[model samples]
Target chain A: MRRADRLDRLQSALDAGGYLRLKDAARLLGVSEMTVRRDIASCDGRFAYLGGYIAGGLESAGGMGYILDRERDAHIEMKRTACDSAATLLKPGETVFIDCGTTTTHLASRIPADSQITVVCYAMNIAEIVCKKPGLRVVMLGGLYHASSASFSSPESLEMLRGIGINTAFISAGGVHESLGISCSNFHEVEIKQTAIANAVTKALVVDSSKFDQVKPAFFAKLNSFDFLCCDDGIDPARAERLAAAGVRIMLP
Target chain B: MRRADRLDRLQSALDAGGYLRLKDAARLLGVSEMTVRRDIASCDGRFAYLGGYIAGGLESAGGMGYILDRERDAHIEMKRTACDSAATLLKPGETVFIDCGTTTTHLASRIPADSQITVVCYAMNIAEIVCKKPGLRVVMLGGLYHASSASFSSPESLEMLRGIGINTAFISAGGVHESLGISCSNFHEVEIKQTAIANAVTKALVVDSSKFDQVKPAFFAKLNSFDFLCCDDGIDPARAERLAAAGVRIMLP
Candidate 1:
């Protein structure tokens, strides 16, 4: 198909549905997924490729919070791989705390719809997804809501978190630097993450390969604090070795 | 325009956008809103006019939980009036606990986007709306999620709610019989409602007139327990007098 025709088809699909999956778009356009990706990339902010889906022209993409959705879309495959690896650690009949972030959201998605487990989360997106599964019981940590991240937190909520006994807490961070330690963008999340880490029997830090060697505003914990680091196979060999040497067990999907 | 033509236009618009406002639909069809309503009402479930918006032929209506959405759509105008009255009781900087119900969800929507206040809620639908307002602080009570209602509850969460100081709690119920007392469908919500009513300085029951003199399972509190009953003028004069005589101050919007 001609480039113009493909673009027209993509635009119309977006207009009709507000969003379309890349694979679905590929099938519709009679082209490969890569070609569809290229088509979206070629456009200048006219459309957005969000978490394996192509959303209509910017301003908004239905609900799901556009900012979080956009961030979730970036490096989605790697995040999915990391989450797939992280999900294996979850055993049925166990309580797990899933943190707020694009990475942990992916992990929440990877949880089986029919699995019998209890999920504890602080983010709306995570709760929204997991609450639909009949077999999974969801516990949401409620506090003051921060819109930028679609998360809720407070001093009281943090205290509430300290009381819950979690088997495994899958924490996500904006930065995971060896020397600088781990951090995230929101300060409110700092105490909640720290509390969840402290309470959980096993603490697993779930992040994509892209977060390595980066640091953000709020420092939560040290990289060596986590029992396992779940990520994709995209980590550099030297960096992997350094992390291993630092006593961080890395789990790849 | 012909009925067939109006139906075609409505169907095509729904196909393109999934949902459209009733006013917008009327404008598009170049007819009165009542005509559009009649057209939709005449159809045998071909489309759904939900909360002033016409959703595409059902199965799903793009999240918002189809069940809750359908219930909310029923008697939406009355619910809006009740919520509008309930919102007036909210003063800046006051902490209010909004309960989990379609009526209270309407109340949450009526809250100004730029208002400065603290909102404590246990329902996802309420949190999703109030959290977006930057000036307002939202505290979510997390617990075992009931997907049927999109609300969370637990014994621990009820304990957590007891600790928070709420100026006013706008509660909703499935049934509000004069003699039978108040009740809801889910038994899990019983303790939470009782706790919030017990904690708040002012207990406000916000429900449409349709809920008056009805009874359901899981009784929580008596009708006289509420300081104010917010509803529309659609309420029967005798019923209103009976409630007022029972020491319940009815607030109409």
Candidate 2:
């Protein structure tokens, strides 16, 4: 087979399976492991120990492909849509506090560059986008930086929030229940979100419809604390009405 | 003497010296322990068991006075001068990465409002300033948040940094030895500084003159890693020449 055809097949295999080990790629491609290594070298691929042959110089393509693949799934698209719809509430020339989460990150990209606002965020990925915007001011709160989410959250974040009042806050909960309110999986995140809400004039909760009814361990604030709830149209109308009755303005997209 | 004046004297005595027990304050003010407690209550002050009177919310006038008195002997002026000098390096429309330190906090205040730039930082105080800026982009790296210095640093910061490069990096070092290179007090900070250097085209070392001879436990990088050294005029001429000879351009203000 032509080298290009072999590479194409390898790419297909990687894209399909999310990852390809050295030995597995060799067997699938009908090539020696040395040949596979040479191919990786020729392509300037990154080979991590556990995470095999990550495409090099792809800008955003080097991570474990499962994350990227999962991000592109239909279910995730709904979450992204909900996050995008929520981004519209942010006004120009205001300071916004953003917490860390995959859903909140989607909202970060939707924030207009011309809005000319300041963003205070704990998520590193969101901060990177906010930093790229010439008109936006980005503030990163310092605290224990969590490796999993690439964000900082701890008692220090709470203390820092106490020093400044925010115009608006965008937060995501792992689980949302009518009575239990917003719940998170991590205690430190709960503390950070609680403090962020305490310091904000307006609070918006951005969660996908699927996340409803699934309760996480740590209970943060009540649902009533949020001024607005932005979710996908997949949410049941009856549930939406219940939240609306509790004084949350629901926006479905 | 008037009750207020007597109370003021008692407070001063407590402030000027070590932690004063309740009995000490009472004896110094020539009042009963109950009277001292009443005075504390009148001022809305609460005492700790061992930590002394956890100072209450004093109005700006009293708070400023108290802070000034307490921090006077600290590196107040050195920190201020370092901040002033570091602020000069920032131009409008530049994304700058500031490491965590008292000196770097000084630089945070100098960022211009009208100038459009994203400030990516791990320091909580710096993020607060970015949030307040009318026109600046602030991106914060997420990692384990450390309480001592109010900053975040971890492997997560390294991974996030690998994806994007910054225009410039302003890093602080605990120790700047002529031979041993730039070092820090902690490994986490060293990792952060190393990552910041890798992600930035230009690296500027923001150090006070007093830090020239100091030595810390963790070494981040060599002295040659920095393109420019921003320090106050207090830096010794001999040492400056040595740094210059070592290919680090010095910026003294």
Candidate 3:
């Protein structure tokens, strides 16, 4: 194979699998381990650690290689649709509360710059987006920095929340079951979500279809806590009906 | 001086000044620099490198020493008094949000453990207190950790916040003025405070009397964004009246 073809094959293997041992890549490329190492080095440190090479700074390849190379199973497009639908419910002048999660981030891009609304958030990404909105105001609650999610939360965030109220709050859940309500993988997140519900006049739950029926370790609040539950069209109708029966206005698009 | 007395003197010097150079300490103790280094080492790394030797790990002291010594500030009592009076507005069972800063941290201790409220925060010190409060639900936001204040902020935190709301937001401003509104020293903090206000129904500005009239780089909100303004009795009456005229209920103690 040509050197370029070998490199392409190596990239394809790494993109398909998030991580690869050196020997595996070598075997797949039908090249010696030394040749594989040399090829990786030619890429200028794009290959990292035991996790293998991740395509970095190659925006021209449609940003596909980087996303595919990551191990996450969630679909970004579904999350974006959910977020867009959630953003439509917020008025220009209202104060909107946002929680942290990859799905909720899609709402940030849709928030209109002309809106006079104030956005209060625990998610740093949303805060950055709201800050750029011309007339929109943004607030970030201070807390412990969780590196994986890149957000802050602690008892201090709750303390600062005393005496403040919100017009609306948007939340995400790791799992949504008729009996389990909204659940998350971390106990700390449950505390934050519960507090968010307690303070809002209206609550909306934004989650993708894939999250349904999946149970996480912690329960933050019951499904009844939310006035609106937004999910993609892929959600099972029976489950949607159950959510609607619980007084949740279900939105599917 | 006796050995104990010498140690006390060293500590006192550090307290009086923010730091004490090792060479300076040696001259004062009538010992060589090496001997001083050995003496400090005897305390088992209690001394920190402050370009030289600084007292370390003395919690009783109130100043910042190389060795993590707590030093007594001349304004300690005044700050404590201000913090005590400000903390009374917070009630139990309410979701509280705390902003990031040294003065706001003082309020953390006053939160009664018996209260059934959940606390969400970005301040690490405040989380420590919430952890001690039995049955108090503590939620921590995850994000990029800021070493200066030991807090976190990032896109992930914004995403996480989409799921929750706060009852009240307790925010501190770099500058609180009748004309300029509430401002912060950094853009990131401004965004965070704005998010807190939007998430809550009520907004409370907690500031020392000295913070009034100071202008910061970024504007978080107008003075009227808050429902209540809590400050020390030392605020100028004219300025307080101006704030009250701007629709902020002034609370002075």
TM-score of each: 0.72, 0.46, 0.42
How far off is residue A154 in model 3, in Å?
2.0
Best candidate according to DockQ? 1
Which candidate, 2 or 3, has the higher TM-score?
Answer: 2
Give the per-residue lDDT digits (tens) of candidate 2, residues B16-127: 1113456766776688877767676675532222223322111111112233334333654565566566667788888788887656755765676678877777754355
- For model 3, residues B26-140, the per-residue Cα lDDT tens digits are 7876878877766666665334433463632222111112111121133333344556566777877788777765556556555666787766666444453444444566666
**Model-by-model lDDT, in order?**
0.75, 0.64, 0.61
In the order shown, the candidates' DockQ scores are 0.14, 0.02, 0.03
| Model 1 Cα lDDT, one tens digit per residue, B1-253 | 5996578556534422235668878887789999999998987566655556675523221133456445643775677778778988988888899998666766775666567778888887677557655578788887667776678876657777888899999999888899989989888888888999999999999988898778888899999999999998899888889889999999997
Model 3 lDDT, residue B167, Cα: 80
Better of 2 and 3 by DockQ: 3
C-alpha DockQ for predicted model 2: 0.02
| CAPRI rating of model 3 | incorrect
Worst 10 residues of 2 chain A by lDDT: A55-64
lDDT of 3 at B66: 14
